[model samples]
Target chain A: MHPAPSVIIFTSFSGLGFGLLLFLGLGFPPVTGWVAFVFYAIAYALAVGGLLASAFHLGNPQRALKAFTQWKTSWLSREAWLSVMALLVMAVYAFCAVFLDTRLTVIGWIGAALSLLTVYSTSMIYGQLKTVPRWNQPLTPVHLLTLSIAGGALLAGQMTVAAALLALAAAVQVAHWQVGDGALKASGTNLATATGLGTPGSIRAFEPPHTGTNYLLKEFVHVVGRKHSRKLRMIALTLGYGLPVVLLIIPGAGHVLGLLAVISHVAGLVTSRWLFFAEAEHVVGLYYGKRSA
Target chain B: MTELPASTQKKLGLVIDLDTCVGCHACVISCKGWNTENYGAPLSDMDAYGADPSGTFLNRVHSYEITPAEGPAQLVHFPKSCLHCEDAPCVTVCPTGASYKRQEDGIVLVNESACIGCGLCAWACPYGARELDALEGVMKKCTLCVDRIYNENLPEEDRQPACVRTCPAGARHFGDLGDPDSDVSRLVAERGGMDLMPEQGTKPVNKYLPPRPKQDVSHDMDILAPFLEPVAEDPKGFLGWLDKALEKL
Candidate 1:
């Protein structure tokens, strides 16, 4: 399966959209929508950034708008349209709330609902993909929602329990990775089939089609350093997941620790996701002989 | 969103038996034939008979040799097509409303006019059902012969798919699988049918009943068994006398 940066963007970007709106809806002292404008600016910037990132994936980006028509069923359509709408709402709410009044409860609540809905929609998009069992769970929504909220709160410099939750989440994510890793290991170290090419087997090798890796091998198919794989997995699981959770409970460590936690979480997740991609042997790879027999 | 009609409708599907498929690629040829002529564009080849000849196709068959549990390892020709899943990943992954599942017949359709050619649906699908048509500059896939299936011009039975009608082996079948009483459904039920990739949870209406062998086989090659060395080559000279004694006994 193609590693959708949209799924990544949807999770990462929508956090800003939803996080800003959630605080506004809660009647927390109204920050000037100008400040909320920062959230909106970053939110939509990432939204557009995500859109552009996705644009790189297609053969043609000029024709991307034709996708907006089928929101009746397509989650991608919903995510795209709603994200744009969320940005518009954020902009509109910014202009009205900041320039006019921040006390407009109805508008804030509506904005909040839309933002959270956007995040939820983003989560559900990947969550519904049962083919990738790793991403197919309610935890995907919960994880992404928390991450976005954590991200926005961090960006907004709010060192509340959101940071604490981010820490716990980072911790849990490590554990989650291990659980998935173990499952994959038992199933021969991949989301698909087959484990590794070590010494001997009932089956043997074929000469590779390319001496240098091809595009599919480079982009879609990849293998990482196996020498220290077990150790790295442990490190990723521990420091990647554990360090952040413990940081949350530490007093006077909320903001900086939250920032560190978010950074670490992203870093760990990047590696973890990379591993996820690397570990997943595409059934196509079997035919190409790119994957080990 | 317009509310879908609640009237009784059928999710028509095709179940092509692998035991019978010859991997002739007739279905692929016919699918391209129909989509290109009817749809906006034909499947294009980047370099036909050249260094590369990549093109879009809604259906492609893969040949595999599967060793059945109780039979000889035989070549099982599998035709890969859109399962036309109830929860189509291609439909959900579309950023535009171009990819959609029909409420009436549960047909998964791609609206070319609305598609921006983002190719998100391509990534979302584990089955690689949909393909980008280079000539049309849009995504295309099997329509289940939607155009001909419902056409009033053709005879009642002639309206079905060209592939199904043309299949010389009678391996391909097209009917409403959603209705439990339909012929397709009955065939599936009696034969213990299965989805190609049920783990995806797309809930594809199309089914594939694993081939039942016409005969059985049982044997284990003992390649690892201990070898019997010639006693004459052995250094035990007493062994010759012992062998002679044992032979006489």
Candidate 2:
């Protein structure tokens, strides 16, 4: 996996943004007028900005509109459709709250569900990749969903709920890493099976196809050092999950402390998201003799 | 549109013989040459003659060393391209419906015009078969030379994949594998051909014929021992007098 900057930003920021929208749609912090406008503005910026960032990684962003057509079989297509629907519904819901000063509970509920579903769809884009064994697990969706809801709660200023959700997010994140560590080996794809040469005593890649690099090697054969990933994991856990929970639960914690918690959490989310791609071992790497997967 | 047809009329794919491939990479070069000129995209290269050169290649040959349980190590040349799987994951993962498997011939292809170049299809494939053209920003893959294979413009003998046509070793065979009576299918049956990564359950149409077991010749060294047996023992008769004089001196 490349750990592409555009994708890291997209996943992290968009997850947080949609998480906020989900909370607002559910009427958490129930503020109307300019206050509601500020919330909606921030939410849309994160969600839309993340999506735009995703487009940056595409080889042909011009044809991205066509991406909406294949939802029946493609999770990426489902994500595009779900994100659009979620954002559109949330916009209407936000407009009513900001201008009409009305709380349409049904519409708000629908928007909240759509927002959540949008995040789930995004997770599925990576989760459904059986080629990347580390991501092909039920925990992938669980990790992303928990992070979004927890981040949303924090943004909505629901300290008590945020604290609980953050704790749950931490658990899921740790479990995800635990399982992902051995996923490639567990998948049973290696040089032997990859080349159909297992009948021999043992097999090892002697030479690659070319002396020069190729798209597959560049994109799928990323090698993140163990020490670096371990350090990033610590930073991600401490700032993204641990610190937020502590800050939210601390007695007499005020606005300044809340702002610090949000900043810390966002920073942590970005780090963890980087690891998400960097650590993913695509099975295709076996052909290149890069890794076991 | 990304949904695969219930069944393809023919499972058209390659059967590569690992035993015969000399790892010369002739098919790889031929594939690149033909595809860049004939296919939808030119298979562009970045920094081609400079440092960090990279390019999109539909077919590639990788070499591997395998040690048998009882014999010496053997090198096998593995050429990989799109398997054109019965359950092609790349097709189903395309968000733009640009990637599809033909219901007629079972050739998986990317409609480059419709491609967003999101690269999800590349990620979905386990074989690393599909590559995104850096310059064109569209997916490039082995169409199995769809143009050449079906082109009425070419001579009947030339109407096959560029790699198949160019293979000097006769290692690459192309035909309908779905037809049990096809030449390729018969070759597969005789050679005990196998699929790559069957556990992934992609149900690949392509098959690989494993290298036959090697013969051990270490014990045959005894035949050469007689030639080295005292051919100059005690020197020649003329040199014997010189040896005696040297000993006296």
Candidate 3:
């Protein structure tokens, strides 16, 4: 719930990168020469840059290589392994498409599948957290997948596909927020249940453990005002999904509109991701008597 | 390695009595003082002496005011730490196998050497048991005083968690919860000890003894009339006059 900058960048940018790679691998909006090179550049930069940015969130970034070994049980490990596999497969696919002037459909399909799988694993990293009720739900993966696909479509200049996916993504995002708000409110635990004092009429925090902040408070106890959150949600909804939908509908073939849509969507997603982290209510907050999270 | 064993050899944990805890924070301080120099990294503080101080600790005590429907309000001191759950998500979620639950005893611990400190284990826990050391950039948590518990150098009586050993009110108990015959388990059985947030499905090893019902104090005593006869009718001496003047002032 700390909403560290590195993680936000990693999740959003890498999702867009993989989404674009998925389209390229499927040979959508087929292009070659300088155009292909530029597409590949954006895809590689986003995918690789996002991967590198993820390491910065770790306490010891140098030891990140160890993370690849525990894919059997850890979603973070799965994400690491899958992202690497996708990137490597995409590299081969890119070489065939750009240099050999051949699109090996089989390898391209494999690369595309892997790329999407990588995004799913990233979403699962947060989605699997049962401690944070707001995130541990079916909607989390839905939101992640739809947003990535929409962003990827826009980046690849597939206007009609982008417009449709953008609408779908916006709907999913709205649905996710609606469900999330209710889920947090309806969490089973409360101050009484948390402390096993349910027989008492009411439980109130008479005194905090300490006057000063501690690690748990700093990392998990983020409190955002409802008014402020509502305002930000409006801003995110407008910038992230609405503007892209509007730009693509203007009936223009200019590259500028497509680029603007991508930028606007990415910016909107940043705000959404921030809200995602900020609004998440960890169950541990119950120990401190935080009513909602 | 992060997968919990099918069954631990012994379920060693603490059972804290809520009624007797007294909210003194002695266990919290003792845990911090001993653990800071023992098995793991020192509990570090950021801006310790500044206007806003923050730090890491293995144990914390939360005080709550409980108002019952039929009685006066009472303050309950609730101390919390790692419950060493039977189905610990913290261990399974660890990407580097740094976080693990011991098979010999059901003690969840972190291997500092292997920890990348990504903090997924902390996120997996519902009890707020784990914390990250700001200075070392590694996760630190209650080892159940593993070093002290197993150390032969310590006196036989002192071979327990520092919190349990130092609690002035004897509210903290550490022993084998798996053995029904153990003092802690027997105490739990006697006191009707209960788990915290059983719905989370962690199946915590630790238990809490609930507070006893309050006595009806009002029924035992008579409402006597005024005992003192009005302070000798406002001053037989200079001292009395001064007392009345001070009260008025």
Q: Rate residue A189 of model 1 by lDDT.
A: 23
Off by over 4 Å in 2: A199-201, B228-230, B234-236, B242-249
- Whose TM-score is greatest here? 2
Q: TM-score ranking from best to worst? A: 2, 3, 1
DockQ scores of all models, one per candidate: 0.17, 0.86, 0.71
Q: What lDDT tens digits, residue by residue, belong to model 2 across residues B66-100?
A: 88778778888899999999999999999999999
Task: Give one digit per residue, the lDDT tens place, for model 3 in A1-293.
Answer: 78889989999999999999999989886756667778899999999999898888778877888887778899999999999999999888788777877778888889999999999999998899888889988999999999999999999888999899999999999999999887765667666778988442477778889898887887898888999999999989999999989999997657888778878898899999999998888888777777543
DockQ of candidate 3 (2 decimals): 0.71
TM-score, candidate number 1? 0.69
lDDT of each: 0.61, 0.92, 0.88
RMSD of each: 8.8, 1.5, 3.5
Name the candidate that leads on lDDT. Answer: 2
- The order by descending DockQ is 2, 3, 1
lDDT of 1 by residue, B94-159 (tens): 766667778879888877777677655765665656677666657777888888899898888868
